[model samples]
Target: MSGIYIHIPFCKQACHYCDFHFSTSLKKKDEMVLALAKEIELRKNEFENDVVETIYFGGGTPSILEISDIKLLIDTVYSNYKVVGNPEITIEANPDDLSPSLSFRRNLFEELKAIGVNRLSIGIQSFFEDDLQLMNRAHNADEAKRCLEFATQYFDNISIDLIYGMPNMSNEKWLQNIETALSFNVPHISSYALTVEPKTALKKLIQTGKIDEPKDEVAQEHFQVLVDKLSENGFIHYELSNFGKENYFSKNNSAYWLGKKYIGIGPSAHSFNGTSRSWNISNNSIYLKSIAENKLPSETEILSKNDRYNEYVMTGLRTIWGISLDKVEKEFGTDFLEYLLKQSEKFIADDLLYLDEKILKPTSKGKFLCDGIASDLFLLNLE
Candidate 1:
């Protein structure tokens, strides 16, 4: 149930709201491709005892890569690690890269399928021209529709990303976005609220009054609609932001949520191995040089007992798989368990949390605030 995440650090253009690590220029694309494969081969021993059940190509824009580059990377994974019979291989792509108008792009889906890629996570933030412009997405309204029209014919387990809480989006328009996505009949969807992160173009725009700030009340309204609409249509609200049909849940994401060990390759990527976590250097030049010199360009830290407990609480509260009260008592002792129940008393009394068969979970009223609630129960600066 382990996975590997490969970060692609190049994008055609920058999205206004994005604070992720990426370069707009593809000047070093060829060199990057080789470094990534070499890093994959270099880190094989770390997972010698674990079989990789998923391989996720995430990042600046994986769809921009040549099909040969993709094949080589997947092949490197096979050559180095013990992979499952049918691993869930996914690529995060933008619609501009998947447009069927270009000759090479027309064959992209088929070639990806031939090379063992079984899933596609398309970065389709919205379906309206205005929303697309606000987010500065690479694809327009028409391209989003056209790509899905063709992509659905090629890949079955496709998951598209949609952003809610845009400043000027109307309630009717938000619902329209949902309905249009439903029209595609895809099995999974991952949606998120558009937050103005610091240092990004989005934050600056908001500060200068170039764009209106996204309202929290509006976000809450959209979230309720998203959950109800998706659930009514047979999509399970498994994880807070992700909805999936039966047997179609993302294996890579599920493994990570359940606290499984995973190796992350490429610059600005993070990795966890049950007891500790590590992250690679964010600078591309440093990562390339280190890999060439047979060194891992990364930093590592071991998790303390309280840190592990805090992490479990944060992740558990956000998923349908609630925190197991029995496991808490068993692993963290009566003292920790008592502290948990005491800290959760107010939420439970407010009907925001409840105990079901000894498992602690958030009620529908509290799901949207799980992160805040979990923080209240954190084991911070205490024994």
Candidate 2:
């Protein structure tokens, strides 16, 4: 089974730390929706042999769109694609957009369920007012709690995004954030450290000394707190940055980790088959113009053997799946497997990685260092 990702490229405000492509203006919303529908039709043939098992609506805040507009896009997919009988449909929303004041009029949560959206991934980065203002998030702390209260009443397949490691975030605040999330009894939580991406406001602030840089040690402490608390509460640390109760892992992201095929539609969306990958133009205006002219503004690349293997190691080491030596030997031949084993000896001896039969996985102490270890194990193309 395959998956589909729809990007909604509009937001009400720009978060200081976000580097994702999006426009804060809504002047072209209607036109962009039309262009998205056109793009879906244009790419349907790419997935002719696969039945869509998941439909994910991610973006510049998908909660900004009207329910009718969302339905239009879903209808386009249903009409053109071979989707399963009960595909998991998820929409990423922010707290302000789902607040009682805004949702009471339309009963947004119930409407979403009626229209086939089974899951909601709310962007509740923190449950503290200071952190919200510090990140310049569009919503306040009260709205965050209110939305979760409303959402849990209607949807059980819910996930919330949280952020840690802000310059001013203390351990107390970070622990409170986790406890606040638990208070809602959410089945899934996706949390990440505050990263300063180049060209983002956070980077500029740090460069000018307007804000302090995020401390790696502090972030590591926060991560440990997250893992311990969640594990004690019966949540599985299935992935480095994700925690879920039984049967509640994110199917869409899990498919990505497993290297399944998925078609991404809209500006800045990415698509991957087993052998190649492609991405749409990041500019909304250019994307709409191209779609209007019956053209796709995108670029594709065929993966090299080395590229595929490196990606496999990178993703595998970050999750419970680990790396399978047998699969490597079978798919990439003995030379590659031998090279991997030779390179892994030092880390294995240091207790950063462990070998269980034929599978290699990161030890608890090495989980935070998985990326670095994976890079060290990469094979430089000798050709």
Candidate 3:
């Protein structure tokens, strides 16, 4: 019912489009790892709920850490928290982090498995050299392809990330990307349409005319291709960008979509309970110093009724479960819920939404524009 996310805010290199809080230098890796353990101990009982079903090691790149560091984290969690038996523990990895030869360094994967990391989310942004160059991702195309072959030998619950709608990426290339993922037999695949996030190097490049501006129309086309090809390959379009085969979906991510409470550790990580949201300072040095001083370094916000409604719309509309009219009415009053249902009517008529009993789910056609539609339905207090 509850989960924990620890952000390892360090990467070997910064990708152009990445805006996540990470230091390219590994100088603080040892100190940061220690700080994470200390923080975990400090906030051990923060989860009022006793059941912890998922633990996710996310961020800059968890795979960059030594096996001992990962083990130390797992030990800390098990010792300090009430981890459920057989909890889903995931580590985010990059292709370059994994060994190229399957037979070589076999102990690395075994050691990780022994330490209870039951899942791996590998960042294989693209399987093309040109795309890798554009993103400035550390791994080459071949490394991306080979790492999965090795991973499948040791891990079954594997999720690979891919980027679509790269400049000059045709429909044929997009299809090939999906086909490449299928060939790896990866149980879960997450594909995202590249966006020029604010303050990211990608945005700067575009502004400086070093890179072409991304086209929304091209992104939309690739997204459609992603959904269609994955569905045809027997992958369920569970979330907007996530496709999973059978029961291979990510438990941690699914919890977020379901509005479940979670505690996030480390800098720039966000935590949400049913009522309020909190986030840590994005600066690593500040976070470390604060935690070292036995201070919980985070800013807290209590959600207003309108804020809660907006969050519900944003998270719910992005998933397969969608927003529930009955739940909304119960939580946000009949008037607000009525207005939401009324707003959805036009979308439903336009084949962008579907009404199933008391539920309002987005159609496949609406998935790409989910955020925009959800924002449109947000309850803004004009008064």
Candidate 4:
């Protein structure tokens, strides 16, 4: 099945740890919206024979847009593509944008539901004031709690994001963050370690001693806590960093992990069609100009057999669906399968990975290190 992702490249303010393509200014928002719609129409031919199953609104902050604008984009998708019956439409939101009182003017949640937007992924990085300040989030701790309380009333398929392993954050505080998020009863929770990306304000702060670097050991401890607590709460650790109740897993993200084809619209968004991948320009102005000229404005890369194998191994090991030895043999031939077995031998011996029948899956102890393991198994393209 195929899906579509629309990136809204704008945010109220830049988070210290964020490096995503977004402009804090709203000067070109109107133009950007029209350009996004035109791009959707322009690229409709790519998915002419495919049925769109999920429409995900991700990025800098989709909630900042007007309700009408959000609806217009969804409408544009419908006009150009063959959408599935009751497609899983999701919008990534920031807590500050959600109304404190649902009865407020225009009622954002109600309007979104009216336009077929069924899911809300709120970016509730932390529930503590200190953590919020450290991350330079626009919303305070109160907004994070209040938004979820109001959101749960309108949307059943709700997901909230939390950041763990912050500098000076105790294990108790990290657990409290998860507990607070659980208290809201969101069906899905996506948590990640506070990483210091190169060139991000966070990296600068750490280098200047303004903020301490996030410890990897602390992140490992928090991940364990997250998995245990969510499992106790009846949420499945379906992927490395995602926990969701049965039947509430994110269709959009799951599709990506399963190697399903999807269209990514908007600046800096990436698209994949099985063998090839493309990404739009990160520059907002350039993306708009290109689309205005009726061009796709993206670079493409055709995947080699080795490239495909490595990707499958990486994505597969990160999810509940691990790499299938049988499928690898069938698709990539016996030589690749033999190489996979040889590469995974050390991990298997260490109990980091185990074979369930012919499917190779990561063990509980190895889940956090899956990415590293996957990388080691990658076949360097010498051809």
Candidate 5:
């Protein structure tokens, strides 16, 4: 099974730490929506033989659009692509858009359910006012609580995103954030450390000494707190940054980790088959103009054997499905397998990684350093 990712490249306001491609202005929103629908139809044959199991709407903020606009995009996909009978449909929403009055929220929730949206990934970031201000989020702490309360009444499968390890975020504050998220009874939580992307406002502030840089040790501490608390609460640390209860794991992201084929539509979106990957233009106007001219403005790259092997190791090490030596030998031949085993000896000796039968997994101490270990295990070239 395959998946489809729809990128909505617009937001109500810019978050200080965000580096995702988006426009705060809605001047071209209508045109962009039409372009997205056209692009879906234009690329329909790419997944002709595969049935779509998940349809994910992710972006600057998908909740900004009207339900009708969302339905239009969903209908376009249905008309052009072969989808499963009960596909998992998810939309990423910000708290501000979902913090309307009770009546309005009920109507919105019903409309979404009627249109086949089975899951909601809410961006709550934090429950403290200071943390929200630090991130320059549009929603206040009260709105964050209110939206989740209203959402729980209507949706059973909900996930919330939280940010930890801010510049001044103390351990107490981080624990409070975790407890508040737990109070919401969300089945899934996707949390990440606050990284200062190069061009984001957070980086500029740090460079200018207006704000202190985030500490790696502090982030490592926060990550452990997150893992421990979530596990204590019966959540599975299925991925490095994701925790879910029972069957609530994100099917869309899991498919990606497994290296399944998916078609990404809209500006700044990415698509991957087994051997190649492609990304669309990031500019909104340029994407619209190109679609109007019946052209796909994108770039594609063919993956070499080393590139594929390195990617497999990186994604595998981060998830519960650790790297498989037998699969490596089967897919990349015995030479690749031998190289992987040889390079893994040091880490294995150091207790950072362990072997269970033919599968290799990261130890508890190695979880935070999985990416670095995966990099060390990479074959730079076939030579």
Candidate 6:
């Protein structure tokens, strides 16, 4: 089974810490939507052997779209692609866009479900007004709570996104957010420690002395809190930033962690087949103009074996599943596999890694510093 990811690069307002590709202006929403529809048609033939199992609409905020726009995009995928029956279709929505009495919102969910969107990933970064305002998020605490209540009727497979480690957030408040999500019985929760990315508003605020820079100590403490709280609630820490109860793990994201092939469409969107990776240009107008001319608007890269192995190490080491030496030997050859084991020996001795049979996995103590550990294991040069 394969997956499809469509990027809807538009948002009503920019969050302070967000550096994702998006525009606050809606001038080209219609044009971009149309372009995305056509782009889906152009790339459908690329997934030759697999039936599409998951379709994720991710971006600045997919919830902001009109029902007609969503339907048009969905129709294009169905017409051009061999989408599997009962595909796990997901749309990333924001809380402010959901309203209980809005017929448009209700119909949007119904129509999307009718067209096979079975999951909803709502961007409810925080449920506290102060925290929400601090991050310049569009939704208030009340709307964030109500959105989930409104969504529960139509969709059971729901996930909420939360952020921690903002300057205004305290440990007590951070844990409270986790409690609130659990109280609502959310099946999946993706929590992340806030980082001020360069070129984002938060970064500028820090540079200008408008706000204090985020403390890494605070973020590290909160990360542990998240792990403890979620684990206590029976949510598996499946990936570095994801927690899911039972079988509610994100199939689309899991495809990425397992190095599965998927198509990505829209400006700044990324796609991967087994051998190569490609991404659309981040500029909006360029994407619209090119797709209108029936031209594909993406840059491609073919992966060398070493490049692919490093990617495998980067993605695999972050998960609950440890890197398997046997799989490495089979796929990457005995020499590369031996090199991986030799490199892992130091971290293993330092209690940062654990090996069972032939599989090497990170210990919980090693997870926080996983990036450093993974980077050290990369082959300087590989054939």
Distance from true location, Cα of 98 in model 6, Å? 0.8
- Candidate 4 residues lying further than 4 Å off, grouped into runs, are 100-102
lDDT of each: 0.92, 0.92, 0.89, 0.92, 0.94, 0.88
Model 1 scores a TM of: 0.98
Q: What is the lDDT of residue 43 in candidate 3?
A: 87
Cα lDDT tens digits, model 5, 1-383, are 99999999999988999999999999999898999999999999899899999999999899999999899999999999999999999999999899778788889999999999999999999999988998999999999999999999999999999998898788888999999999989999999999999999998999999889999999999999999999999999988889999999999999999999999999999999999999999999899999999999999999999999999999989999999999999999899999999999999999999999899999888998999999999998774
Off by over 4 Å in 5: none
Candidate 4 on 1-383: residue-level lDDT in tens? 79999999999999999989999999999999999999999999999999999999988899889888999999999999999998999999988899556575238888889999999999999999999999999999988888888888888999999998899988899999999988888889999989889999999999999998999999999999999999999999999999999999999999999999999999999999999999999999999899989988899999998988999999999999999999999988888998999999999999999999899999999999999999988988533
Model 3, position 238, has a per-residue lDDT of 85
Residue range with the least summed lDDT across 10 consecutive positions in model 6: 99-108
Instruction: Give me the candidate number with maximum lDDT.
Output: 5
Positional deviation of residue 159's Cα in model 1 after best superposition, in angstroms: 0.2
- Candidate 6 similarity to native, TM-score: 0.97
lDDT of 1 by residue, 202-279 (tens): 998899999999999899899999999999999999898999999999999999889999999999999999999999
Tens digit per residue, CA lDDT, model 2, 34-97: 9999999999999999999999999989989999989998999999999999999999999999
Worst 10 residues of 1 by lDDT: 100-109
User: Candidate 4: lDDT over CA atoms?
Assistant: 0.92
lDDT for model 2, please: 0.92
| TM-score of model 4 (CA atoms) | 0.98
Q: After superposition, how far is residue 271 of candidate 2 from its true place, in Å?
A: 0.3
Candidates 1 and 5 compared by TM-score, better number: 5
